[model samples]
Target: MNNQLPPPPAQMMQLITGFWTSCCVYSAAKLNIADHLKDKPQTAHQLAEATHSDAPSLYRVLRALSSVGVFKENEDHQFELTSLGNTLQTDAPGSMKAMAIAQLGDHYNAWGNLVYSIKTGHIAFDNIEGMSVWKYYEMHPEEGVNFIKAMSGLTGAVIQHVLPEYDFTSFNTIVDVGGGNGALLVAVLDKAPQAKGIVFDEEYVVAETKKLIAKKGFSSRCETAAGSFFEFIPENADAYLMKMVLHDWNDEQCLQILNNCNKAMKAGSKLLVLDSVIPEGNEPHPGKFMDINMLAMTGGRERTEKEFASLFSNAGLKLARVIPTHSPMFSIVEAIKE
Candidate 1:
């Protein structure tokens, strides 16, 4: 084995130019190039006509992506979708298409101003867009819907790893606080057969969540509620699940949400928080990067176990355990109402 790292300059250069790859992937996703290439290989000219893009320009982009193994270029100049590229397809299981578009489109400007966020200790997105992301979503419904889809896709990708690592069967009622689209709740209900669930979120989000519950044929076992976690949560659930919710707020806001959950929880109830629990030291963890993303986008952060314990204690709960999933990006932070 080589057992050696890349030279510092080479590594630094790659890190500096990482956005070039991101942009290339974003372009392919934006143009639906993966979907077009899904069936079979096609020449750039053919793909260009289908996507209404310039043949030469599209070919150049495809060629660039091919170098990184997203797609493969044949001897005759036809591009074929690789396994990695399949993830960008619109309907692929755990698709990244929406994520690609949103991060590069709506989130691009905010990320560009990351320095401003660091300097001011504020959300760059709010400053850049002149409104909070939640408000911006309200004004631009299309982008809002896409943002929701992006989240759903991300949740879908991690659900398998999360479900198998923990037991949900003991609870009679599972409340997915801030659960969007009912995907996680529906999946949990499916695993727990006897348990009913509620997909709780804001009114507009819950309206869409209802449709997903009904579409999944879980309408009988799962329901949707409209409200904010800051004000209230559905009361007396056996278990409450908050997947990727708390990380969107600062400590003060998280305390408010957690306090509400505590108020609604019974003495014995369990709260399962599904988000990254960042490790200490110079680890190459995704949560560290995501922590920065949270800072720029929502004024939130990924917390360490100590930080979570503090939040739990202040919110009238005790940290029970932190269970690891197969995926490194998430963990089940189980807490209990005392």
Candidate 2:
């Protein structure tokens, strides 16, 4: 192809320097960077002073983010909000600040031990933190809330995408397993007036879901159930829905969850596993990296369509179809309780 290629390994350089981007995000999140810049932009020194950090170092970080178009640098060295950076600000319309902070917190450490996860198929978090991710979240309330908020923040628009894609009108009672804060269930029930739903999750977390149900005026039709996914799921449901649930667990445990759903369902019951169906080829999808994140944090792996079919078969169900979304990151993998 080209001849003038004896230079820096740009690809490798990018890979190695990827952590720098993380550092910048963390730096911004830590400085209450987005919060400070919400109403107006400020000088780097002013931002650093307000955040109680070293001025010059903060300036450097801001400049790095500016280079990536997260923020715009003026000739006067004032950093102004760019469109991309505004998404990082905390607010309803566009918010990912919480997510950035959480990922940069405990997740960063777990990701650091990716080799351990890849080699042994064990959660790197357990080895590094001496605690399971669940246990850690239970013990750390603030971080747990932040994580949930982050998830809700990221999945905001996803609610709109789901309503039009799936046929919820055909079903009556839908139970959302591990439904955190009842966001998805709320969305579905709000859209489908004929359908009733239950949000199932742990007692501690389901408390929040109850509040959400009440707030959303879904109290009459939507209920919250406290339960564990591994032990058992409630019986008597027309449809079982699990969104972003399975990928947190390994195949064995995934089967356990599916079987639990199977035991609860009658024939002809629909089972919707809302997750990303890993596509074939190295076509540069973000989900591939998400699969790696699962590997690093939990002993779970994302499944391809064929893998889902096999998995469903193991749980005494048949994979009916995979409904692709406008979102490449997620799909509705439909199965049936047979």
Candidate with the greatest TM-score versus the true structure: 1
Total backbone clashes of candidate 2, pairs 3 or more residues apart or in separate chains? 0
Tell me, what's the RMSD of every candidate? 1.3, 2.5
- Please give, for residues 275-335, the per-residue lDDT of candidate 2 as tens digits: 8888898787767888998887877878899999999999999999999887777889999
Instruction: Encode model 1's per-residue lDDT on 1-338: one tens digit a residue.
Output: 99898999999999999999999999999889999988889999999999899999988989989999999999988999999999899988788889998999899999999999989998999999999998998999888888888988888777767788988889999999999889989999999999999999988788878888899999999998899999999999999999999999999999999999999999899999999999999979999999999999999999999999999999989999999888888999999997
Evaluate all candidate structures by whole-model CA lDDT and list the values in order: 0.92, 0.85
lDDT of 2 at 37: 85
Worst 10 residues of 1 by lDDT: 154-163
Question: Candidate 2 clashing pairs?
Answer: none
